[model samples]
Target: MAEFPRTDVFSGPKKTIKTPAWEPGYIRDSKSGKPREIPIIKQLYDVLMKLPRDTEKVFTVPKITLVRYFQKALEGANIQDFRFHDLRHTFASHFIMKTRDLPALQKILGHYSPVMTQRYAHLTNGHIRAEMEILSAVWTPIWTPSEKSVPCEVQKSFVK
Candidate 1:
């Protein structure tokens, strides 16, 4: 599943990671069983452009080797219990929080069903806290009466 995308896949600003129809592997379209095109940002496009393209594939190393390298990087950084697949979860959570668009996220994640994308789109604690803060404006009183002052009618209306 960790197929390093081919250099040929890059078209202009976007780098679409789709399996070819004739030579297919993991990239499966849930609806058409072909492939989906996901757009890559300009930053990523620039970074990928800088890489040396000696081979047809963008990455020179094998898939397994890249996984090993990722694992090594995790160990070096003292990160624990993190997997490559976890990146999808992290991306989904941040994307949803930032964009607040589930449908857009589903398309980006290539989820055939919205349910699958929902599984990944978890709201972080900070994001939830930020959302709750929006309620403050609604609850705020337009005019706060003076605590020390009392109306004359109320004083007169009071029974001994």
Candidate 2:
């Protein structure tokens, strides 16, 4: 009954895990009537591959289970204050840094607005500044007063 397809291609002693089922058709469950796809990841694929063949009940993997796994993995790695969601942040940050493709990143992150995607815009500051410098270099003052029309010698001698 789970909406997301488990892409795990492996099997374990528990043969019930490898069966494929249709992903539930998208539905509108809220007042806004928006449809959403289930979030799938490679880790879920691995876990599903190890499931028993006869498992009939839809298994729910909670966020806490992932958080515990994250904590265990980081226990001796010398990292501090890591959260499971930080993986998403790191993915978004690195993707933006490497590709500089805001629209692609926004789609990957499932954000509806570019404003939400703009959080990663700061990563392109170097490019942004370089562009601004390029624009500034091309722009120049159009007019200057004649030296003879200046009231003071200092003003008259001013270079255009």
Name the best candidate (by TM-score). 1
Query: When superposed on Cα atoms, how far off is each prediction in RMSD?
Result: 9.7, 10.7
Q: How many clashes in each structure?
A: 0, 9
**Which residue pairs come into collision in candidate 2?**
14-52, 15-52, 15-53, 16-52, 16-53, 16-54, 17-51, 17-52, 17-53
lDDT of 2 by residue, 1-160 (tens): 3444455555655444433332333221222435444344556655654566454333445558867877988987978887766777777877777787998888666678999877744555786787689899998866555656645654545653
Model 1, 65: alpha-carbon shift in Å? 1.1
Q: Identify the runs in model 2 with alpha carbons over 4 angstroms from their true place.
A: 1-60, 120-158
If scored against the real structure, what TM-score would every candidate get?
0.66, 0.46
Q: Return the top candidate by lDDT.
A: 1
For candidate 2, the lDDT comes to 0.60
Residue-pair clashes, model 1: 0
Segments of candidate 1 deviating more than 4 angstroms = 1-33, 140-160
